[model samples]
Target: MSERDDEEREFDLKWADGAEQKEPSARARMLAARWKENPPGPVPFRADPEHVGSRRRSSWVSTAVVLGCVAAVIVLLGYINFRAPY
Candidate 1:
């Protein structure tokens, strides 16, 4: 074999010896241990009294606006179809 072929084989052999895996850092291990003792609890739910009424009112307004838009589109399409020569 040529020198190039020998050098290529040597490189492949060296590369095949994969890198060693590393353990978690000290901070990561500490956090894991701490959570094991006392893990997080479920999130608490909150109710806003003042905003509830406004939210319902805005929902009704939005529904009215969407319905109005649909009606306008249907009327415009009917007008277009009626005006079409074909």
Candidate 2:
């Protein structure tokens, strides 16, 4: 608003060369892409048959096999008994 204030403002802008004196940061980067890292390598492992789920499946299979054999034996005996009179 006064002549002295305008002079001080012009003096401040006179130091604009100071802004260009500094260099940009070397480590600064732009437009970086994001990435999700995959596992380092293939796993050297196999599924264990004794795992709980595997054990249950194996138990059912064994149970079914045993029941089938018992049924077959029972039927064989009954047929033999029926034919003994012949």
Candidate 3:
């Protein structure tokens, strides 16, 4: 084989053997240790006061839109099924 072919084969074989394991960096280890010692507090369940009204309003709007679409489909199907033949 030529030099290039031999080099390519060596490269493929080296990667095919799988990667080597690596130790975590000092900063990563320090952060992990700190979190272990003092974990974060639980997340809040309630929405913020300013956002609460908007969230509720948007949810109601979305629900009304879905119900409107469903009602339209139902009416269209009923008219198609029961309408007189032309």
Which candidate has the top score in TM-score?
A: 1
- For candidate 2, give the lDDT of residue 80: 97
lDDT of 2 by residue, 9-71 (tens): 888878664576755454432212111233345654976655769788999999999999999
| Alpha carbon RMSD to native, model 3 | 9.5
lDDT of 3 at 84: 61
Provide the lDDT at 79 for model 1. 100
Candidate 1 residue lDDT tens string, 7-85? 9998987776554765788999998999999987876486577878999999999999999999999999999999999
The clash count of every prediction, one per candidate, is 0, 0, 0
lDDT, residue 1, model 2: 64
lDDT of 3 at 51: 93
Q: Which should have the higher lDDT, number 1 or number 2? A: 1
What's every prediction's RMSD, in angstroms? 10.3, 24.1, 9.5
Q: Model 3: clashing residue pairs?
A: none
- Stretches of candidate 1 off by over 4 Å are 1-44
Error of 2 at 22 (Å): 80
Model 3 Cα lDDT, one tens digit per residue, 16-41: 66668757889999989999999878
